[model samples]
Target: MSTIDHPNTEATSAEARVTSDPVLVSDVVRSDRLLLADNTVKNHVIAATGVSLVPVPLLDLAAIMGIQVDLMHELCKLYDVPFKEKLVRSLLTSLAGAAGTVVAMATLTSLAKTVPMLGSVAGAAGLSATAAAVTYATGRVFIQHFEGGGSLSDFDPVQFKELFKAKIKEGAQVVKSFKPKSTTNTDQTAQTV
Candidate 1:
């Protein structure tokens, strides 16, 4: 058998490798959507980690929540699901409530910032990780739901409880892999987007 050198190279892509086969085309499109969704999740998770550094008790968590909501809204757009802010918020609360310990840890981490001097440091340390994990898991579960033809209107947080917990563990590793982006670049990217 003969093999091409550097088979791992991007010389062959999902679309390029396949003919006009409907099944293969659908697979390529699905694969592309997944990559896009993953990118969107990573960007928002990084932003949430930054927001966790806001240094104010509860305020940081509040900011992180807003970021999570925005992440969900973007995912909704990507999946062509109805984007209802109020419904999303309710769904988020349900998710967080199901996250129980993760949510509690995040709250405790945020509250730790109330200390006179060391509070900021402690909160920043804990909240950043917690926020990244929670945000990432949220994005991931949403992506899975959308991929399975589920919409936000029928999303059940209870059904995803175990998966959400597992994803939080996965998310911690993902967050550590992300390097912080510079403010100038972030600002420019935001403006362009």
Candidate 2:
């Protein structure tokens, strides 16, 4: 009787782990470049907008849905819950507010150059109205998207509300406990009073 010997995969995997250089420099370099690019864009926006640089929330919604703790940790490192909420609100507001001005100027400029026969005022007004409609539609869509996320209306609204209330109560307690040291002059004034 002849017996066929199969190679053991587990032993091979164990042997491979010892020799593998897990730290890949190319991957590190790429990640560093991405970080640099992100910083550059953030700096440019901050310089132009005069707003503090708020990092984008690092949570992958897909990963969160899959219940990945590592992704949650990564997100916490990038943005806290309150800051993430604030960032979303800020983005929504900015997109809603800026759409009209940008669209109006671009459309008017384009129309004015393309159809010289149409007097500037008429062309500008037509373009401006078109831009306004587009902006309104865009803003509405953005708001709808924001509201669709249901930050307030959810399965565990009661629990979340209680948690929020508890946090506020805790904060109030902490504030109440904080006592500013009375200076000598303040003590003297108190004594006089």
Which candidate wins on TM-score? 1
What TM-score would each prediction reach against the true structure? Answer: 0.80, 0.22
Inter-residue clash pairs, candidate 2: none
Model 2: runs farther than 4 Å from truth?
1-109, 113-118, 150-193
Q: Compose the digit string of candidate 2's lDDT tens values, residues 1-193.
A: 2223536666677779976868788678656644643343233222222111111111211221222122222333332222244444344334323444543443444345344444444444443333323322322232232233433122132333333334333433433343366579888989999
* Pairs of colliding residues, candidate 1: none
For residues 119-177, write the lDDT of model 1, one tens digit per residue. 88888888999999999999999999999999988999999999998999999988887
Q: Backbone collision count in every prediction?
A: 0, 0
- By summed lDDT, which 10 consecutive residues of candidate 1 come out lowest? 1-10
- lDDT by candidate, in order shown: 0.88, 0.35
- The local distance difference test score of model 1 is 0.88
